[model samples]
Target: MASPQYRLVYWPGIPGRGEHIRLVFEETSTPYTDTATTSDGLDRVLAYVQGNVPDDNINPPPLAPPILQHLADPNNDTNVTTISQTSNILLYLATHLPPGSIAPDPKTDPNALFYLNSLALTALDGLSNEPHDCHHPIASGLYYEDQKPESLRKADNYVRVRLPKFLGYFERVLGSGASGGGKWLYGGKFSFADLVLFQCLDGVKFMFPKAVSKYEREGTYAKVFALYQAVSERPKITEYLKSSRRQKYSDGIYRYYEELDIEP
Candidate 1:
């Protein structure tokens, strides 16, 4: 019997939260169809968010894009399992994908998966989500222009305080010896958490080039910066970075606005 195919439903243009899942797929060389690049990708993505895709499996429906669906047959929904939320999708994929693709085996280290999930969550909360709010400080419903003044103030504290605090935390994690005393975020093996942190740092560096560059130059978070470099240089990741599949940063989770850009 043939194996099920993984399908990723997300927005077409920007990487957004979906990029974290995409990196896992790419790094692991997992075969999956990304709706964003398909002919009717966005429409399919909206089907889930709009409650148009009827599946008895999903209750309450999903509120946004970046949903993952496992299909025994792409053309049939009999054995379909759909799930939303980036971290949830990553955790699911980590366990379902081939061994050593992106996570350690839970059978051996029972706490490994949970620990990695915690790490990924921390990176998302402190780096991705907070950085996004720096541009839309007042409200997600309001446009960046509508909240520019408040955004500027938010960006100031983010760059000077929050950014470093998060970076420092990760650096401490790397040096803590709890991560199996290696570059990997957990168990001394490459896991989804490492990818999460790498993507978060990549987005932050793009959005706050000045602040990130200063920190790197000063070697304040050397381990954190080093992890970024290591992940960037990975064979598959290097190819992905150069490929068209890797989307550029824009008005997504991490946005660059000169008015809101402040040095730490």
Candidate 2:
């Protein structure tokens, strides 16, 4: 089969949901273009969210950014196929890459890519719960100050209960040697799942250092952390992370709100 042409559209600021897709593309050394490059890039992104997104599909995507345009389609000009849910995007990229890549063969392998992705998705869901508990006041759309009391209450709960639960899961997964009996998230291979976990870990650590510290006391998942470092340094990934398209943590979903910090 011919190499698949690629173009990735995502939000302009912050790594957010798009970073996972970016990491997957980078890891495979697949050439792709970043569609959102400026504040205007976000404008283009918003339009897709509100207008261009297909509503009639059996599996309509849940949110925006990280939409992959499959440029290799022959039946149409730049035929677009979008999959949201960060984990789903990761799974898609993992299985669809050119043969003999990082992804294990689903038909013959003892551990399937989809199964590992499912586990990683569960971890991500837990991480999101931790963040929401840190700042969920009246609604997700409001500013932290707008929900200070609720945010404080929620953050308190995160430090006490939720943080350990999520971190513990990762620690166990690593210790289990699930990644092909090697280090990392699953099949011991670098998959999109690892990128998602890394982003979640980075965001939580950035948001709640004290809580993260407390969780770290249970012992850091050094294997996954090391894998993260390795993936970050990959040629294409390193370039994208340093490029203008790479958003600072300040903007978008995973804000480093000072108040979100709690005493360990």
Candidate 3:
């Protein structure tokens, strides 16, 4: 008998956070079921949260949209192991991969890898803040239109400063790799950091194309963009991306709101 199998519980719509986990599993050729594509999916997830999980031992995290369930327990019960937060999920998956497969082992003192991951998460944190600002510039519960004026101010700063700083750091990281002499963020090995960076780059590019074009041309970050294209071209990745699993720009951290794109 094989393990119960892993389950990813996330919103049925928009790839968003869960997509990161999906992409990693696809890249590693791991088998897992997406448990949130319909009422059944949502119910399955809700049931787990309510402590009605099939596997009595599997624990549920506090949040949603990116929980990984380890179903391989021989207990044959529906007990689930749910993990929240995209970064944590990615890190967990990184360890499961054949060591050094997704990310550098902590033993190698992969300073570059560690730095790159940190940089990626930092960008994501900033990105999340920006979105909240756009929707609830003054307060989280307020509407975007109600806070349009304040949202514009916040968005302006992000576009002019915060976004560039984040992009620039990754560009430098990619350029520093000596092994391939400018390929991949960490160079030589394709660590999880690159994956996270690519997602960030794409998010910003989609939300603010003009701004991204301006920074991407700055030369220092060219390799980072190139790495994104290269990774997308990987055979397995290409297939996975083509499948419905790959999220659309409309959904996720990098949402497109034309009104938000203000040009000088």
The per-candidate count of clashes, in order, stands at 0, 5, 8
TM for candidate 3 is 0.82
Q: What is the lDDT of candidate 2?
A: 0.68
Q: Candidate 3 — worst ten consecutive residues by lDDT sum?
A: 54-63
Residue-wise C-alpha lDDT for candidate 1, range 1-264, written one tens digit per residue:
454388889888888999998998899888778886789998998787787987574444777878887886766767777788889999899889886778878778788888999999999999999999998888998998898888888989999999999999998899887877758778788889999999999999889988999999999798888889989999999999999998888778988887766777
What's the TM for model 2?
0.82
lDDT of 2 by residue, 1-264 (tens): 444466677876567667777767766788676765544666667877787655645446546666776655634544566666667677777777864365677777756776667766776777754575466557867777788888888777776777776766676776775656536667666656666777777777777777676655555656556655776776766787777756677655556677767875
Residue range with the least summed lDDT across 10 consecutive positions in model 2: 71-80
| C-alpha RMSD of candidate 1 | 1.8
Of 1 and 3, the candidate ahead on TM-score is 1
Candidate 3: misplaced stretches above 4 Å? Answer: 1-4, 44-60, 106-116, 127-132, 177-180, 218-220
| Positional deviation of residue 29's Cα in model 1 after best superposition, in angstroms | 0.9
- Give per-residue CA lDDT, model 3, range 25-134, as digits (tens): 88878877787444588787676557564443436445445677765474564544567778877877776667776776767754645565575587567655465455
Best by lDDT: 1
